[model samples]
Target: MSTERTTGPALVVQNLTKRFGERTAFSEVSFEVAYGEVFGFLGPNGAGKTTTVRTLGTLIAPTSGAATVAGLPLSADNGVAIRSRIAVMPESPGLYLRLSVAENLSYFAGLYELPDRRARIERALRSVGLEHRADDLCRSLSKGLRQRVGLARALLTDPQVLFLDEPTSGLDPVAAREVHDLIDALRKRGVTIFLTTHRLAEAEQLCDRVGILNTTLRMIGRPDELREQLFSKSIEIRTRAPLADPDEVFAALPGAEGWQRSEDGAYVLSVTDADTAAPAAARALVTAGADLLALTPIRHSLEDVYLQLIDTDVEAQQR
Candidate 1:
């Protein structure tokens, strides 16, 4: 576990803006990731997710705005000083295929000049479940093993902040799950994580608070918070009968908005609150001569929130 250091903000950005030509990738973007926080950045394609990550990683300079990392100004060393305090696992990491796992870690460790280098390397290998393959070359390792090596590379820095950009992208489900387990372990060790992923479900599972940064940040909160914001006190009732016209049935409950049919001709009703709306909906279904088979609250997942935000923006632009 990491020993606690100074109690200050881990990373802070204010009015961060980046632009090129006539287009602006991101503007007026600001957020604070406190120590031990697993902050997530979510957005659709070209919504500036990668651009934002690149700027935060200090790989590129923001057009305007100020950011302080680990209590140091971001420009002192052209971001070098801040970069030293952070480790990054890019979305597509380029690994040295000819180098053994241990060698790869040592190569990075040597650059960072970490103390007790060999011991740190060994500890990181075991931490990511790569102890047995420490001697194997990267080229011969499976995709999952290679990912562990990438993580091991980052761990060599002994950084306070770890930037993971789509850390589990394109891997098999099992490998992705393993990556999540590693993240969980890292969080327990008190490493602040900034995770960016297109995978809404994974982000929902791992992030403490997620910011949907499409064009602008449409929403920022935990998965459950987003659910409550987008679907507060709402429920979907699935019935066995067609109930072709649900408007006449629910005219009294005018707050209900979205109504649709399930694949089996079962109908669904969207309401304000399940606790109150659900019982009334169940009664309404039965009164309408519709066979009520399942009267359960409909859960709006992160994907639902993501899609709604995206579609809502696209629609706004269309208008």
Candidate 2:
């Protein structure tokens, strides 16, 4: 999806810092959420993910720093203005048990003073595919549907940006998939989704760009960008030997790291770069008299790159 550049960023946080005495939750963090990008905010536990969002949401004042929402500077006079254009969904949006789904949605809509409120509630339920259950008590609904109602509440404002924290935490596989679908639909409609997730698959598939924040922002980019920058997006080879062992032949070749032998004694080799090393990797392995069973390039999956990014930060602190 093409994101239109905004008159200014959809959101901007500059030099954001938070501290509890000497225990700094974050230090001088800064980043921007553009007009129509689903930016994933992620980190390990206590890496200040929630702190950063709370600061931007104006739930708690930053120790020092500033943020703007939809071009309005974050100030006392405009904090309400900033919030008016944004929606914040906490990790757990425990709904009112007594209220029906429609009641719950209408309540939030009223809070935002949304016009044509009944029609908007209908649209929200339809958007999340919860129209069939719209009259059920929130407590009577399934966990996933409850979450969808929470989302529907957030959408009532038609906010330019939505901050979702662990929106699918307790759902089953099917439920998580449903929540994911909801998120994807919102992104397509050009609403910026700032999500904090332990669900790597969700982040990988849904986010256009991700910022791995430390006490400060550590790294930010599209998944592929960080993957290629931080790890080798290379290829692997697995082969069955015919007449000779691979090590005796491939051990001396340039760009070929040492080979690995599977439990069944097949050989697996790692190369520096797939495009550059594939031909040589192939020639060397084959000429070694090993039968090639599989030759596949390894792209840096989000799971792999996320570990690398988080680990790098952890190691820095350890040092």
Candidate 3:
């Protein structure tokens, strides 16, 4: 499915900071998430990711700064109105253990004061593929199933914005995939998603942009852009046979920063520019009588970029 980008950002945060007395949770965190965008919020625990979400969700107030959710200004006066336009599935499912799935959803639907509560409940359950288990008590469901039920509950209000905190945590592979599929479906419908996940793979697969927060806004951009910013281009070449002395060939290549061989015998060459260095490296290897099998640029994983950023931030703070 495709989304039209004509609409402005679904959420806008400008230097938003929140503090509790002397403790500053996060400071000057700013970003904008366009409509239909899945913006990933990532940070280590105590990094204030949750605080930022709570502030945006209107559960807590910001100390200073401004934001708008769905074009509505974020303030105490707008809290009730903002809640109506958004749904938050917190780290915990927070379902009533004794209640049936349908009952738990119905309870929240009532809180939202949604009309046609029964129809809305059914639709939400179906959205998460949990209609068959509607009558099952919440306690009886497994962790993954419980997660789905919580998701269904969040959807009952047909929220324009969704906040999911570790929505797939503790689920088996199959269940996690189910949640991922549901998230994909939501994005197709133009629902803005604010996701906080420790799973870098999931963030890489789903988020349109990511913001790293650690007591302050550290980095915010598309995953690829952040990766490129934090690391240089690299190229990997697999040879038909290992060269007698690979170091000499690699050292001769222009713009070659460093080189290493993997356990599988592929040469990983760090270069100033993969586009030009790749060809030169290939020629250098072939000239040395090494048969070439494959040559490809390497894209750093989000995890790699994230760790590097954290480390860099730590060192800077120390100095």
Candidate 4:
């Protein structure tokens, strides 16, 4: 079954909620993923990350909300249609140990009842750079090789949207990087990917935008945007010696909102604009007759953003 291209967002979810009896899996979650964009879904364990994927994937129905997956309304009636347009690659590929790489893909192709099965299988294997291993038994392949096979299976349908749940769960750095490269390749091919992972660095590196979830939608934006939203922009100034009168030097500086001295005798200035503050601070130090060592903007990683929100939730629960 071929999936026709759709115009609008690849996925649209509005106030989506899911509850299992008394336990709420996720509540009032909403987000959209653009076609050909890699949208990262991030959260800690038991934070409804998987549940959100399962819900959006149509494996489980939402309790009270509307969603459109692959341009089709998310409903029991559209389940088959939605499944046809999207593919889900779990952490484990779940291949038969006794089956050869080609045989495993052949099995799934049969399930999808795809046409030109041989041609599709060849293309899928080639996409993941596993054409050479088609004859190798899955059990004999390394974990990383097995992962490539899983990805190949996901591509057999040429899905409009691909959901990858921890695509690099457990592997050496080398193996993990291999999978990252494949994702990069797929993104360049204009494949829309919905990636769910606990690895903040991976999300930061791969996703165009990311949503941090904790039983609810906590935040959603580009990684840098999230950092700017949650953190104040600041410039770090290191000097050969502490300023003679730090307050006097930085107090009247343009674009600087506030200043603080670090334990290691560095100065950190909260700035409205680094472009404006950096040069001004440099001249201020020279005028004060202080030896300037370094002046640079401090950058916060996505992990910092993830922890800040998740930690806030923990503190609230404690209270």
User: Which model scores highest in TM-score?
Assistant: 4
Name the runs in model 1 displaced over 4 angstroms: 242-267, 280-290, 314-319
Residues 1-319, candidate 3, lDDT per residue (tens digit)? 1232335678999989999999889988789988888999998878888888888999898999999997689999989888878889998989999999998998988888889889888888888899999999999999989999999988887788899998988888898888999999899988889999988899999999999888888889999999989888889999887788878899888899988899988888999989999899888887898889999999889999889888878733553
In the range 179-261, model 2's lDDT, one tens digit per residue, is 99989898888888899988888899999999887677878899989887886545656665443655676676667666676
For model 1, residues 4-79, the per-residue Cα lDDT tens digits are: 4456788888888889878888878888888888999998778788888788788888889988776677774757
- Best by the lDDT measure: 4
Clashes (candidate 2): 0
* Model 4 CA lDDT for position 254: 92
246 Cα displacement, candidate 2 (Å): 4.9
Candidate 2 lDDT: 0.80
RMSD to the hidden true structure, all candidates: 3.3, 3.4, 3.4, 1.7
Q: lDDT per residue, candidate 4, 1-319, as tens digits? A: 2446788999999999999999877899989999889999998777788988898898998999999999999999999999988999999989998999999999999999999999999999999999999999999999999999999999999898999999999978899999999999998887899999878999999999999888888999999999999999999999897677888999999988998888887888999988899999999989999988899899999999988998889733643
Where does the lowest 10-residue lDDT sum fall in candidate 4? 310-319
Between the candidate structures 1 and 2, which one is better when assessed by TM-score?
A: 2
Residue pairs in candidate 3 whose N, alpha carbon or C atoms collide under 3 angstroms: none
Ranking by lDDT: 4, 3, 1, 2
- After superposition of all CA atoms, the RMSD between model 1 and the true structure is 3.3
**TM-score of each prediction:** 0.86, 0.87, 0.88, 0.96
As for lDDT, the candidate ahead, 1 or 4, is 4
